[model samples]
Target: MQGPHPVAPPLVALTKRAMGGMRSVGGRLACLFGIVAALGACAVGPDFTRPEAPVPGSWQNAGDPRVSTQAAADSRWWKAFEDTSLDRLVELAYHQNLPLQVAGLRIVEARAQLGIASGMQYPQMQVAFGNANAVGLSENIAKIGGLPRNYFGYQVGLDAAWELDFWGKYKRGVQAEAAEMLATIADYYSAIVSLSAEIARTYVMIRTFEVLIDQANENVALQEKALEIAESRFRNGATSELDPTQAATLLESTRATIPRRQTALQQARNALSTLLGQSPDTIEPLLVGPKAIPKAPVTVAIDVPAAILRRRPDIRSAELYAAAQCARIGVAKADLYPSFSLAGTIGLDASTRGTASANLFSSGSMFYLAGPRINWAFLNYGRITNAVRVQDARFQQLLVGYRNTVLKAAQEVDDALVGFLNAQAAAAFEQNAVTSAQRSVELAISGYREGAVDYQRVLDAQRSLLQQQNDLTESSSSIATSLIALYKALGGGWELRQNDPVVPERTQNEMKERTDWDDMLGPSRPQEPKKNAAPAKH
Candidate 1:
């Protein structure tokens, strides 16, 4: 190892002298800290209280056996579809969704902001400095004959200033930032809930299109055989040419539907690819398994309507936003009062004049300044009061917004429940229609082959069968998709985050390479409850 620096001894001695000076004022400093601490105990503005909002005691569909008031067991509600591919897609999206990653980065940014606010409780300004100067005295101003005409001066020292939190300005600032950080965390979970629902919805659409396309192809093959039989009869003088022409027209129309369904399938796949944060070409590999609409569970545990206050991330975020604004009112109010601070400067200074030279670090050259300061903006007409009013107004706005969010959440759950029940009923009727249409087509074909009925009967039965089959497919998809909507409306899927990191490890590694995050990028710190604030239920 390299030897110590040549100037280390003198630096150590200088530090010791500075420490000695600090000890001399330690008694007064302690007294000042005690006074400031007592003052900091009481903040200037109103404390935050959770806002109350109206909610129904139970959902409109609660009486149905398919809906339950019991607490939801799975936050990963998509798994109820019993589709391994959907489960895998949800897992992949949790790790790779671009919007979700953005939401996580916002939490990191908010954490840094909280750190900055917390730091304000300590010394506001601290600086170490050194200077050397050459000075010349004017002959006209120097009346003493022994006075030197020129001199050299040097200085090196430290200075600091701390603005006491007499009005709890810094404390309220910390509270605001802490609430904002929690809001960002809620936003991240909200992103998770949205991403999961959107992926499932898109996957259902893809499967719906696949089933419809298959039905259209099957109709086209059946219609082509019908066209061939009509032409054979017309050639043998048993049927008119109009029958063959009509059969060809029906076959072409059925073939036309395939391209439209294919287009929709491709679009759904591309959308899914975006949600997975991958290119469209890569989506095909993940979609290699069976292309069937996921089955929805018969019953969903939606809990009571009041549970939305705690279960919905957006609702929690809205409440946190109001809490953050409530703290800001205090921060703004604090500025109206006079600020008290302690400012001090200590240093070693020396000068060479006449025939004498003094060492810069000598006790004779030591200098210090210490004092308390007060600043009051008494002359600002009505600006400070108006600023406080502005913050209070904003807090009120957020309170109302939080209430509206609660009402909207309840509305969403109600709408989804109605849709799920109605779609299930419609699917039942469509299934019956498809079964009857299939039987009618078989009878019509048999009558035409035995020369007992006209070819138009065959065409009518075939068209009815195709229409009913497509209707049943659409209705079945609606049943599953409606359940997805209900799950999303109830704010399911965010609990998956309890076992996972908000920010991915790969992203954390990349951020570490760019900056020293220390423990900030590690596991999140436990939140400290604010005095007089309601505890948030996660």
Candidate 2:
């Protein structure tokens, strides 16, 4: 068969000369190495460039005094609430959340995959093999020659085949895996962002329920006093028995809400426990600080909208995934060209007749074969082309997905800003309502005591007070939670990882015990964002 290239004749002569002497083999290998080095310099396929995503130059709520366009002063945004308990919970969840640990493990897995891709730059196949077998010749075949009927054959050798990265297939593969590993790291930070916000939100819920229950209990006490007045008035013939009966009904109704609020509080605690990766029973002990809803600061530094591209891990992950897919297109395209490889085997072989033994290690018994090879799947209909198209399609999908992620991130920030601002406004009105309701209750109670008004007025005032108070509490909680949401949307909490490892040391130790992870599980920090780059334009 004809060789794949015009230079095959000279290369064939070189191979033959290599086989003639050991010194010549070394010189030929150096020549071959130089040839491969020169050819391997270029990589095939499209080089990755960050895709442009449109985002607003400024936040929609930038005009609001509470929203600042200055760069965020603190990435530990949970601390903005000035609640020590919330800060502790966030730290705990960062180290203990199961899902976050899984994300870190994925980084380790990606790193190993990268190592596999890198290894392909060298020999793709290598093996040391040995075998022994007894051979028996057929009588009919043996009769035609002066040969023994049976013999023993043995061989031991090292075999290796390295398909060089002449087409940049393996290089592209390494680039893809390297990008994937970075994406996984971003995923880990994304998990941290979620875990921190969830912990703060759940903690706020628990406090909200606590305050709501307190309000209900206070209303119950006020109603109990009103009932006493109604009962006395009825016994003294100053009012009808119907008044006391109505009073009793209102008291029981107010009392019923306490247990329900307690249930919600416990449920919130259970959710927080899960976020911390602890049993529900253990969560109560961690709830030791002041049982008050966290309060947001007067002003929050949200920075410009374009910063989201750099700050949000999901955005980074999406972009990196697209980049990785882009590299895959090159990998598939390389299959269209012929693959070049070098294969060789070196071994000792010997055969022994029935009563005789052979020395397999003798220099004369050793043999080796070495040559360059070429492979072309020229007959594959459209498989390789379609594969390239498939990767390109996926790359396009990820690009679109990345753009969508940016839009959604901007939406979240805008939504949270509106929610936070409006909830604060509503809370002001609710507070006023609570104050008016409290004054009305006092006036009604005084009037009923003096027989200047009906017991119904007192009941109405008390009901209004309870409802207004609960509404105020809910609105306050909303303010804090909305702030948490805004911080989350801004992707602030991931900066906590600057001082922490992606995986907890305890988890790393446990994983090491289960498998030989080598340096993959070691302390590794999230990569810092590139500086001074032009922000993505909206």
> What is the lDDT of every predicted structure here?
0.86, 0.84
Clashes of each: 0, 2
Each candidate structure's TM-score, on Cα atoms with residue i matched to residue i, is 0.92, 0.90
- By TM-score, how accurate is candidate 1? 0.92
Q: Which residue pairs clash within candidate 1?
A: none
RMSD of each: 3.3, 6.4
Q: Per-residue CA lDDT of candidate 1, range 373-437, in tens?
A: 88999888999999999999999999999999999999999999999998898999999999999
Candidate 2 lDDT by residue in tens digits, 205-240? 999999898889889989999999999999999999
- Find the candidate with the highest TM-score and give its number: 1
Measured by lDDT, the strongest candidate is 1
